[model samples]
Target chain A: MKAYRLRRGAGRTALYIAVIAVSLMYLLPLFWMVRSSLMSAGEIFLIPPVWIPNPPRWSNYTKALTTIPFGRYFLNTMKIVVFNLLGTVLSSSICAFSFARLRWRGREFFFALLMSGMMLPGAVTLIPTFLGWRAVVPPNSYLPLIVPAWFGGGAFNIFLLRQFMRGIPLSLDEAALVDGASYPRIYAQIILPLSKTPLIVVSLFQFLGVWNDFLGPLIYVNRERFFTLALGLQMFIGYYTAQWELLMAAATIVLVPPVILFLLGQKFFTRGIAISGLKG
Target chain B: MRKEEAYGYLMAAPAILGFFIFTLGPLLASLWLSFTDYSVTNVYKFVGLANYKRLFSGADPFFYKSLGVTLYYVALSVPITIVSSFLMALLLKQKFKGRGLVRVIVTMPSIVPAVAVATIFLWLLNPDIGLFNEILRALHLPTSQFIYSETTVVPTLAMMNIWTMGSTMLIFLAGLENIPEQYYEAADVDGGGPIYKLFHITIPMMSPTIFFNLIMGLINGFQTFTQAYIMTEGGPNNASLFYSVYLYREAFTNQRMAVACALAWVLFVIVLLLTLVVFRTSGWVYYEGDRQ
Candidate 1:
C-alpha cells in the first residue's frame, strides 16, 4: 500500500509537469504576438530574436491605430455586434419558446426543416443572396450583415435556444397558463428568466460571430470607410506587409473584446459547446 | 388550441420567412442560375448546363484544382485535428494541478478571430526572423519556408488549423466524462495495464464523439477560406486556392456568376454525398443508450 501511494504521487507530479509544458506551447504564439507588439521594428527582425522587450514600446499601439482608421472600424464592428446580439437574442428566444412550450401544428416538421438548414453550406447560397441584397441595397451597406440576424437569428442559434428551453419544466408554463397569462407573457417572464444562462451563451456566441466575421464583410463591403475591424486589418496587412510590430499591435487590439468576453463567461461558453456537441 | 397554434406560427414566422428568403429561395435560385450565363452586367441567358459542362470538359482547370486542394486540406486537417484534440482531451481529463488553467490556455485559440490567427501565423511562419525558424536553428534543424513555399502551404495551414482544436477537444472531454467509471474499475480488477485499458475501454466508448468530430471537421475543412484568403490568397502558383475561394473569385473577381453558382451546386452535391456516405457507414458508431 505504501509503494502504491508513492507511485501514484510520482505519477501526478509528472502529469503536472507535462500539463504545464503543453500549456506553454499552446500559449507561446499569443505571448509572442504580445511581445512582438511591444518591440521595435529592428528588434523584431533581430537574428536571434528578442524573447522579451527590454523597454516595451507602448507607442506601437498608437502608431498602429493612427496608421489606419481603426477607430471607425471599431465603431462599425460595435454597431453590427450590438444589432446582431439584440436580433439573435430576441428572435431566437421567441422561435425557441414556441418550439419548446407551445402546442402547434407542423411544429416537428418545421423544427426538422430548421435542423436540415444547418447542413446547407453558406457557399451554396453565396451568389444569389448577394444578388438578392444588391438589388435592394447598395454595395458596402451594413444591412446585409445586420438584417439577417433580425430574421430568425440563425438556425444554429434557434436550435441551441430551443434545446435549452426544452430543459425548462413544463409546469412553470402551465402555472402561468392557470393564472390566465398568455404565451407571450409566459415567454417573457417565466421562460426568459429561467433561460438566462443559455440566453447569455447565445448572445456571447453571436457577439463573437459578428465581431470576428470576415467573409460577410469581405463579400458585401467594398469601400474602406465601411470596413469592419476584420476587413480593416486585412487591408492593413496588404499595405503594410513588412510592418510586423504595428501589425501585431493591430491584431492584438482586434483580439481584445472576444478574449474579455471569453474570460468573463467561460463557464457558459464551455457548457454551450458541450451541450451542442451532445445534441448535435 | 387554435389560439396556441396561431401563437406558435407567429413566433416562428420570422425564422420561417428568413429561411425561405435567404436560404431556401437562394438554394433554388442557384440551381436555376447554374444553367444560365449570368454575369454582373445583368445579362442572363439560359445555357442549359453549359457551366457544368465547362466544369467537366476541362474548360475550367481551376475548378478541379480547387476541389483537389480542398479535398487535400480536409484529408490532412481533419485527422490531425481529431487525433490531437483527443490526446489533448485525454491529458486534460487527468486530475492534475492547474488543469483548469491549462484547459483554458489550450481552448483560447478557437475564439481568436480568424483574421488575427492569419496575421499572427504570417509572422510566426516567416522564413526569416521568425520564431519557428529561430527555434529550428537553435535545435540545429533545417528551417522551412512555411506557407510561402508551394509545397508546404497547405500543410502549414493544416498545422495552423490544429492550433484551434479546442472546441473539438472540449467535445471529446465531454464524451470522456460521459464514460462510466465502472468500465475502468472493471479493467483494473481484470489486471489491465494503461495501454490495455486505453484500447479495450476508452477508445470504443468515445467512438461516437470521434465520429461527430470527423463529420463536422470534414464539413468545416472543405469550407476553409478566411485564413487562405488572408494569408496566401491562393498564391505561389495557386497551391492554396480552396474551392470556396476559387468560387468567390469567379463570382466577384471574374464576373462569372453562373460558373460560381454551378461550382456552389457541385460543392453542395459533394458535401451531401460525403455526409450521406458517412451516415450510411456509421453502423460502427456506438451510442451509450443503444446497447445493440
Candidate 2:
C-alpha cells in the first residue's frame, strides 16, 4: 500500500513538471518576441543575451507607427473587416436558413456543391479569380474583397449556419408560415433570432480573417495608402529587416488589436467553434 | 416537398451564384490556362501539353525540387504535430492546477495572424544573439546556424510549426472530454495499467479525432506559404522552398502563369487522393456511441 501511494505521488509530480515544461516551450517565443521588441538594435544581439531589456525602448512603438502608413492601413483593414463581417453574417444566415428550413428546387444538389467548395483549395482558384475580378470590377478598389463575400464566396460559413439552422426544430418556421408570414418575414423574425450563437461565430471568424488578411489586400490594393495592417507589417519587415528590435516592436503593435479582441471574446470564440465543429 | 424545394432553391441561389462566379468559373478558367502558354502579356495561347511535359521531365529543376521539399515538409510535420497535440491533450485532460491559463496561452497563437506568428518565430530563430542559439551556447551545446544554413533551414521552419499545434490540441481536448469515463473505470477494475488503458481504450476511442486532425494537418502542411513568404523567402540554398512558395514565384515573379496553374492543379490532385485514403481508413475508427 505504501509503494502504490509513492508511485502515484511520483507520477503526479512528473506530470506537473511535463505540463509546465511544454507550456513554457509554447510561451517562450512570445516572451522572446516582446523582450526583443523592447531592446535597442545592438542590445538585441548582446552575447550571453539579455532576456530582459535594461531599459525598455517604449519609443519603438512610436517609431513603428511612423515608419509605415499605419493610420491608413488600420482604416483600410477596418473597412474590409466590418463590411465583410456584416455581409458574411447576414448572407450566410439567410442562405443557411434556405438550406435548413426552406425547401427549394435542386436544394440537395446545390447543397452538395456548396459542401464541395469547403474542400476546394482557395490556392487553386486564386489566380483565375484575380484575373476575373480585374475583368469585371473597377481597376482598383475594395470591391473585389467585399463583393464576393457578399455573394457567399466560401461555403464553410453558409454550411455552418445551415447546420445550426437545421438543428433548430421545424415548428418555429412552420408556425410563422401558418400565420401567413412571407418567406422574408419568417427568415427575419424566426430563423435569425434562433441562430445568435452561429452568427457571432461566423462574424468573429470573418472579422479575424479579414483583419489579418495579407494576401487579398496584397493582390487587390496596389497603392501603399490603401494597404492594411498586414501589408503594413510586411513592408515594415522589408524596410527594417536588419533592425530586429524595430521590426519586432512593429509586429507586436500590429498584433495587439486582434490578440486583445480574441482574448476578450475567447468565451464566444471557443463556444462558437465547438458547436460548429461538432456539426461539421 | 415541392413548396419546400422552391424555398430551398431560393435560399441556395446566392451560394450557387457566388460559387460559379468566384470558384467554379475561375477553376475552369485556370484549367484551360494550364494547357496554353498564357502570360500576362498575351494572356492566352494554346500550347498543348508542353508545360506539364516540362514539369515531369525535370525541365525546370526548381519546380521539381520545390515539390520534393514540400513532400518532405508534409512527411515530417504531420506526424510530429499529431503526436505533440495528442500528448498535450492527454496531459491537459487530467485534473490539474492552472489548466485554464495553460489552455488560453496554448491557443493564443492560433488566433494571431500568420504574419505575426512568422515574425516572432523569425526573431526566435535568429542566428547571432537569438534566444534559442543563446540558450544552446549557455548550456554548452552545439548551436545551429538556423535560417542561414541550408541544412537546418527546412527543419527550422518545420520546428516553428510546432507552436500552432494549439488548434489541434483544443480539438483533441474536446474529443477527450466527450470520451466516457466508464471505459477507463472498467479497464481499471480489470487491473489495466496506464499504458494498457491508453492503448486499449483511449487510443481506439480517439481514433476518429486523430484521423480528422491528421488529414487536416497534412492538408495545411502541404499548403504552407505565409511563413516561408515572410521568413526565409525560400532561401538559404532553397532549403525551405515549399511548393506553394515556388508556385507564387512562378506566377507572380517569373510571370509563368501556365506553369503556376499546372502546379496548383497537381497539388489539388495530390490533396484529393490523400483525402480519399483517409476516408477509406476512417471506417475502422471506433466511436463510443456506435457499436460494432
Candidate 3:
C-alpha cells in the first residue's frame, strides 16, 4: 500500500511539472509582446536577442500613443462600442422576450427563420449593405455603423438569450401575468434582471467585436478622425512600417483592454462560448 | 390569459424589420446585382451571366488564385484547430493546481485584437530580426521567411489559427464535462487502457462539439480577411490574396461593384453547398440519447 501510494504521488508530480512546462510555452509569445514593447528599437533587432530589454524604455508607450491620433481613435472606438452595447442589449432582449415570454402566433416559425440567419455569412450581404448605407448616409458619418445595432443585434445573440430565457422557469412569468404585469413590465422587471449572465456574455462579445472590427470602418469611415483603434493601428503600420518598437507599444495599448476584459469576465466568456457551441 | 399575438409581433418588430432590411433585402439585391453590370460611377446595365462567366473563364486573373488560396487555408486550419484545441482541453480537463490560471494564460492570446496580432506577427516573422528566426539561429536550425514566401504564407497563417483556438478549447472543455464518469469507470472495470477509454468514451461523446467546431472553423475560415489584408496584402505575388480581399479590391478599389457582387454570390453558393454536405455526412456525430 505504501509503495502504491508512492507511485501515485510520483505520477501526480510528473503531471504537474508537465503542465507547468506547457503553460510557459503557450505564454511565450505574449510575454515577448510585453518585453518587446519595452525595448529600444535597436535592442528589438539585436542579433543575439537578449531576453530582457536593457534599461527598459518607458518613453516608447508615450511616443507610440502620441505619434498619431491614438487618443481620438480610442475615443471613437469607445463611442461606437458604447452605442452598440446599448442598442444590442435593449433590442435583442426585447426580441428574446417576444420569443420566450410572450404568447404569439407563428413564434416558432419566426424563430426558425431567425436561426437560419446564423448560417448566412456576412460576406454575402457585405456588398449590398455597403451600397444600402452609402445611398442614405453621408460619406463621413457613423450612422451606418451605429444604427444597425438598433435592429435585433444579431440572430445568434437573440437565440442565445431566448435559449437562456426559456430555461428560466415559465412559472415565474405566469406568476407575474397573474399579478396583471404588462408584457413590457415583465420584460423589464423579470426577464431582463433574471437573464444577466447571457446579457453580460452577449455584451462582452459585442464589446470585443465592435472594438476589434476592421472591415466595417475600412469600407465606411475613410476620414482619419473617424477611425476605430483597429483601423488606426493599421494606418499607423502603413506609414511607420519599420518603427518596430513603437508598433509593439501601440499594439500592446490596443491589446490591454480586451485581455483585462477577458480576465475579469473569464467565466462569462467561457460560459457564452460553451453554451453557443454545445447547444449549437 | 390574454392573447398577445399583436404584442408579440410588435415587440419583435425591430428584429423582423432588420431581417428584411439587413439580411433578406441585401441578399436579394446582391443576387440581382450579380446578373447586372453595376459600377458605382456609371449607370447600371443588365449583363446576364457575364460576371459569372468572367469568374470561371480564367479571364479574371485573381478569381481562381483567390479560390485556391482560400481552400488551401481552410484545409490546413480546420483539422489543426480541432486536434490542437481538443488536446489542450483534455490536458486542462485533468484536475490540477491552478488549472484556471493556466487555462486563462493559454487563452489570453485569443482576445488580442486581430490587427495587433497581425502587427506583432509581422515583426516576429520578419526575415532578418524576428524572434522566431533568432530562436532558430540559437538552435542551429535553418530558418525561412514565413509569411514573406508565397508557398509558405497560407501555411504560416494557418499555423496562427492555433493561437486563437481558445474559445474552441473552452467549448471542448464544456463538452468533456458532459461526458459522465460512469462510462469511464465501466471501461476501467473491464481493464481497458487510457487509449481504449479515450477512443470509446471521450471522443464519441465529444463528437457533436467536434462537429460544431469543424463547421464554425470552416465558415469563419472562408471569411478570413484581416490577417491577409494587414500582413500580406495578398502579396508576394498575390499568393495570399484571399477571396474576400480580392472581392474588396474589385468592389472598393476598382469600383467594379457588379463583379464583386458576383463574387459574393459565388461565396454564398459555395458555403450553402458545403453546409449541406457537412450536415448530410454528419452521421458519425453521436447525440447523448444515441444507443451504442
Candidate 4:
C-alpha cells in the first residue's frame, strides 16, 4: 500500500510538470504578442529577441489607436454586437421554447430542418445572399450584418437553446398553465428565468461571434466610416505592414474585449463550447 | 391544444421565414445563378451550365488548385488537430494545480480574431528577426521560410491551426469526463496496463466525441479563408489560395458572379457529400445505451 501511494504521488508530480510545460507552450504566442506590443519597432526586430521590453512603451497603444479611427470601429462593433445579442437571445429563446415546451404539429420536422441547417456551408450561399442584399440595401451598410440576427438568431443558437430548454421540467410550464397563465407569460416568466444559465451562454457566444466576426463585416461594410474593429485592423495592417509594434498593439486592443468577456464568463464560455460538441 | 399549436407557429414564424429568405432562398437563387453569366454590373444571361463546364473542363486551373489547397489543408489540419487536441485533453484531464488556468490559457487562442492571429504569426515567422527562426538557429536546426514559401505554406498554416486546438481539446476533455470511471477501475483489476487501458477502454468510449470533432473539423477546414486572406492572399504562386478565398476573389475582385456562384454550389455539394459519407461510415461510433 505504501509503495502504491508513492507511485501514485510520483505519477501526479509527473502530470503536473507535463501540464505546466504544455500550458507554457500554449501561452507562448500570446505572451510574445503582448511583449511585442510594448516594444519599439526597432526593439521588435532585434537579432537576439528581447523577451521583455526594458521600458514597455505604453505610447504604442496611443500610436496604434491614432493610426486608425479605432474609436469609430469600436463603437460600430458595439452597436452590431448589442443588436446581435438582443436579436439572437430573443429569437433563439422563443424558437427554442416553442420546440421544447409547446405541443404542435410539424414541430419535429422544423427541429430536424434546424439541425440540417448546420450542414449547409455558409460559403455556399454567400454569392446570392450578397446579390440579394445588394439589390435591397446599398453596399457598405450594417444592415446585412445586424439584420440576420433578428430573423431567428441562427440555427446553432436555436439548437443550443432548445437542448437546454429540453432539460427544464415540463411541470413548471404546466404549473403556470394551471394558473391560467398564457404561453408567452409562462415563457417570459418561468422559462426565461429558469433558463438563465443557457441564455447567458448563448448571449456570450453571440457576443464573441459578432465581436470577432471578420468575414461578415469584411464582405458587407466597405466604407471606412462603418468599419468594425476587425476590418479596421485589417486595413491598418494593410497600410502599415512594417509597423510591427503598432500592429501588435492594435491586435492586442482588438483582442482585449473578447478576452475580458471570456475571463468574466469563462464558465459559460467553456460550457457552451463543450455542450456544442456533445450535442453535435 | 389549439392554442398551444397557435403559439408554436407564432413563435416559430420568424425563424422559418428567416430560413426561407436567408438560407433557402439564397440557396435556390445561387443554384439558378450558377448556370448564368451574371456580374454585379446587372448583366445576366442563362448560360446553361457553362460555369460548371468551365470548372470540370480544366479551363480554370485555379479552381482545381484552390480545391487541392483546401483538401491539403483539411487532410493535414484535421488529423493534426484531432491528435494534438486529444493529447492535450488527456493531459488536461489529470488533476493538477492551476488546471483551470491552464485550460483557459489553452482555450484563449480560439477566440482571437483570425486577422490578429494572422498578423502575429506573420511577424513570428518572419525570416530575419522572427522568434521561430531565432529558436531554430539556437537549436542548430535549419530555418524555414514558413508561410512565405510555397512548399511550406500549407504545413505552416496547419501548424497555426494546431496552435488553436483548444476548442477541440475542450470537446475531448468533455468526452473524457463522460466516460465512467468504473471502466478504468475494472481494467485496473484485470491488470490492464496504461496503454492497454487507453486502447481498449478510453478509445472506444471516446469514439463518438472523436467522430463529432472529425465532422466539425472537416467543415471548418474546408472553409479556411481569413488567415490566407490576411497573411498571404494566395501569394507566392497561389500556394495558399483556399477555395473560399478564390471564390471571394472571383466574386468580388474579378466580379465574376456566375463563376463564384458555381463555385459556391460545388463547395456546397462537396461538403454535403463528405458529411453524408461520414455519417454513413460512422458505424464505429459507440454511444451509451446504443447496441451495435
List of clashing residue pairs for candidate 2:
A103-B4, A103-B5, A103-B8, A104-B4, A104-B5, A104-B6, A104-B8, A104-B9, A105-B5
User: Across residues B1-292, which tens digit of lDDT does each residue of candidate 3 receive?
Assistant: 3457777998998998898899899999999999999999888989999999989999998999999999999999999999999999999999998999999987878888999999989988888988888889989999979999988999999999788889899999999998899999999899998899899999989999999998888889998999999999998899999999999999999999999999998998898889889999999898877687
Local accuracy by lDDT, each model: 0.91, 0.82, 0.89, 0.89
Local accuracy of candidate 2 as per-residue lDDT tens digits, B1-292: 5666676677667888998988889888888888999878885779988888999899889877898889888888888889987888898888889988888888788787888887877777777766788889889999998878988887787877678777788788888898889988998899999999889988898888887788778778888988888888998788889998898889888888888898888888989998898888788677667885
lDDT of 1 by residue, B1-292 (tens): 5888999999999889898999999999999999999997976889997889889897888988998899998889988899999999999999866778888899899999999999999999989888999999999999999989989999999988778888899999999999999999999999999999888899989988889888888788889999999999997789999999999899999999999999999999999999999989998787778875
TM-score between model 4 and native: 0.98
Off by over 4 Å in 1: A1-6
Question: Candidate 2, after superposition: displacement of residue A133 in Å?
Answer: 0.9
- My TM-score estimates for the predictions, one after another, are 0.98, 0.96, 0.97, 0.98
Q: lDDT per residue, candidate 4, A1-280, as tens digits?
A: 9999999989988897888888788788888888999998788878788899979999999999987989989999999999888989999899899988898999999888877777788988888888888889988878888888988899889988888899989988888889999999998998999889999999988998899889999889889999999999999888888888898899999999998988899899889888899775
Report model 1's chain A TM-score.
0.97
- Every candidate's CA RMSD: 1.2, 1.9, 1.5, 1.4
Positional deviation of residue A229's Cα in model 3 after best superposition, in angstroms: 0.5
| TM-score of candidate 2 on Cα atoms, chains taken together | 0.96
DockQ of 1: 0.83
Which tens-of-lDDT digit does each residue in B25-56 have in candidate 4? 88899999999999878768899989999898
DockQ of each: 0.83, 0.64, 0.79, 0.79
Tens-digit lDDT string for candidate 1 (A1-280): 9999999989888888889888889899999999999999888888888899979999999999998999999999998888888988999999999988898989999989988888898999989999999999988889899898988999888888898889888998888889999989999989999888889999888898999999999999989998999999999899889999999999999999899999888888898889778854
Q: Give each model's clash number.
A: 0, 9, 0, 0
